[model samples]
Target: MDGIQEFNPFSAGGLDQHNDTTIPISDRSSQPAVLQPSQEPTPKASASAAQVELLRQQEELERKAAELERKEQELHSRGVSMGPENNWPPLPRFFPIKPCFYQDFDEEIPVEHQRVCKMMYYLWMYHCVTLFLNILACLAHFTVDAGHGVDFGLAILWFILFSPAAFICWYRPVYKAFKSDSSFNFFFFFFMFSFQVVVYIIQSVGIPSWGNSGWIYAISVIGTNLAVAVFMMVVAGFFTVSAVLSVILLKMVHGKYRNTGASFQKAQQEFSSGVISNKTFQSAAANAASTAAQSAFQRN
Candidate 1:
């Protein structure tokens, strides 16, 4: 110890020498460090690991339920109700129904009246053309005999009897159909048409007074080529068909009339008490008046 050399650290008396036995913290810092939980690197695996599976299952179940609910909603919205009574869309008023005895077309309709009118009009034209052809064919008989086939008296009688029948059975019913939506007119047309069919059959068979023997299918008729007799029958047959078709058209129009929101309350009233004062009727009339006014306004 006496031989130890003196430190030449610039003869510094600032050197600390108070506790040589105790090592300084910096000199012996290799001891295992006490790690703090807050300072440690976080685990890559989520801490919510246990909850994750639960959440996934919950979400999956929720999605399944939502899908089921969505399917139900879609079916409901697609105009398809699931219940027995709710299985179909609303039916239009123009379903398989009989013709109305009265018609009042002034309101919006699910189906257009114009379309029905066009069908009827076309049929009418077809009937007219057919009638004309038939008449011309029958006239051939008269042409062949000239004076003897259908004399003036016979012609006058035929015209008188048949013309009135045509008007009453066919023309009047058609006229009613055009003027109003009437079930009676429709029935009239059907009835008249049926009668005409019988007449046509009679004439086509050449049953003497009705059908022509000069035109097509002349072999079926009784007359050979007597133009007057043949022509008159053809004419009569055509008109007979016309009468029947007039009834059919009347029925069709009547069907469309129901879709028009037309009410036969007046007719009902007439049938019931010869007058109308029911609330339903009063409101209906008011609505009609309002609708007409609005239409007029829009037109203006």
Candidate 2:
């Protein structure tokens, strides 16, 4: 009987131990469960995603800046003038003609040639003034003697004709040559201006009934009137200076043109174009042909 004895749950120590275990189970059920290490959220993925987004934004901004810069450059290339207007001299309102035929000369003229062009413009102005003064000098002599009337009249005619002619013949051509970088125009201007410089020298020689107050008049008037002689000397000096400067400028222009490959071929091309475009040349050619035909018919 003792060897086969069964365990009793209702006994004092056993029942109390069972009740303690039951209460622990209820208490464990009431408490929150703690998470394992693998279950905890990591901030690494979110942090990496934010970094990538920031980098993408930065790249987009850079791309936009580059695109804007490219657009600005394209605008500039298309003749849209850049830079501040304050950098250039203000245009003169009183002048009958604009400083340059090119609307953007200030921007377009090369840095090397800017001073040269400016000096040329100044010389043109000075030449015009000198011509005007020459006329005045001739009139002054005319007031002294009736025989000087012819000189005064000639001086007036010269001024009226030569001023505009010179602007068209040399000044504009030189401007166009530099502006268009045309070698032909440069050569043409060089030849034309050389002739003009010779004219200046001739005009400077003040003759008795001629318009100029050059060395000739300066020497002739020295004994009679010291003041007139001094004036003639001054005028001759101006003319001499102009001639020298014109020669120097011509040399400089020629050097530049040669460097740009101004050749005989280019000169021929320019000559051909001029001949083709000249109405007077065409008329003369037609007349010559007609005359030749008439002669042939008569001979037959």
Candidate 3:
């Protein structure tokens, strides 16, 4: 009793203290942590990149479409509209002779055909200039040798005749052919232009007594008058250049014609149709028939 006398209710034993102790949160930290599953951003990142590429492609296509639209607008502005005013022949308002033809490369000719058509126009101009220069050269020749007066006369005659004739026969036909895509006009141009090429070759050759200031006449005059001969030679060179250009242009036109689906049969058809549809032809036919009827009635 004396040795165990100090045990009281306020004092706790070791087993009782152990039974009341609680485990701390840090004690469980070493156990494998049960974390919520995190989503991988790789699929989302790839999807965003794909969307960005698609957007870039779409923007590129839009830019191309805008560029094409701009080009089309420019082409339209270049006189593709209907009923555009003609600016060719560029004659002054006060001139006695008005422009007879309505010529506009942008309005009348297709873009692909305009270049060759313009070249043909320039060739015609060159041909005119060559003829004028030939006349001058022939005049000089005549001044040196009065016996060559025939060449001067013929040169004047050729200048007067061939200038208009070339324009009407070959140039106009080709112009109309390009303007309307007429098979008959194209064939007519080919025929006339072929003859023109031959004439150019002849003129370049400078045969004696011919109106042309060709190589032969130029060389002949060289002994008599070197100044006149040099001048004539220069003109002869021009004729040669004209001939070469004519040949080249002829081939170019033929190539264009081949692409036009034109044929001899089509040309014939176009000719017949054009003749039938022409007001002048119809009037002439009617007058001829009336005259024939009157003659027959009187005979009866």
- Predicted structure with the largest TM-score when compared to the true one: 3
lDDT by residue for model 1 (1-300), tens: 999977754454523443455567789768788875786445644556757888999999999999988988999899655543421224455876432222232322123454655555465455546544555554555565454344333434444466546555664564554455554555566567667656545544444344333223454334544444445555556655655665566567656656544455544543355225677887888999999999999999
Kindly indicate the candidate among 2 and 3 with the higher lDDT: 3
lDDT by candidate, in order shown = 0.54, 0.74, 0.91
**In model 3, which range of ten residues has the least summed lDDT?**
79-88
Pairs of colliding residues, candidate 2? 206-214
Worst 10 residues of 2 by lDDT: 81-90
Model 1, residue 144: C-alpha shift (Å): 3.0
Q: Compared to the true structure, candidate 2 yields what TM-score?
A: 0.56
The lDDT ranking, best first, is 3, 2, 1
| Residue range 254-275, candidate 2, lDDT tens digits | 7767666667787788779989
TM-score of 3: 0.68
Using lDDT as the yardstick, the better of models 1 and 3 is 3
TM-score-best of 1 and 2: 2
- lDDT for model 3 comes to 0.91
Ranking by TM-score: 3, 2, 1
All candidates: TM-score: 0.33, 0.56, 0.68
User: What lDDT score goes with residue 38 in model 2?
Assistant: 81
Best by lDDT: 3
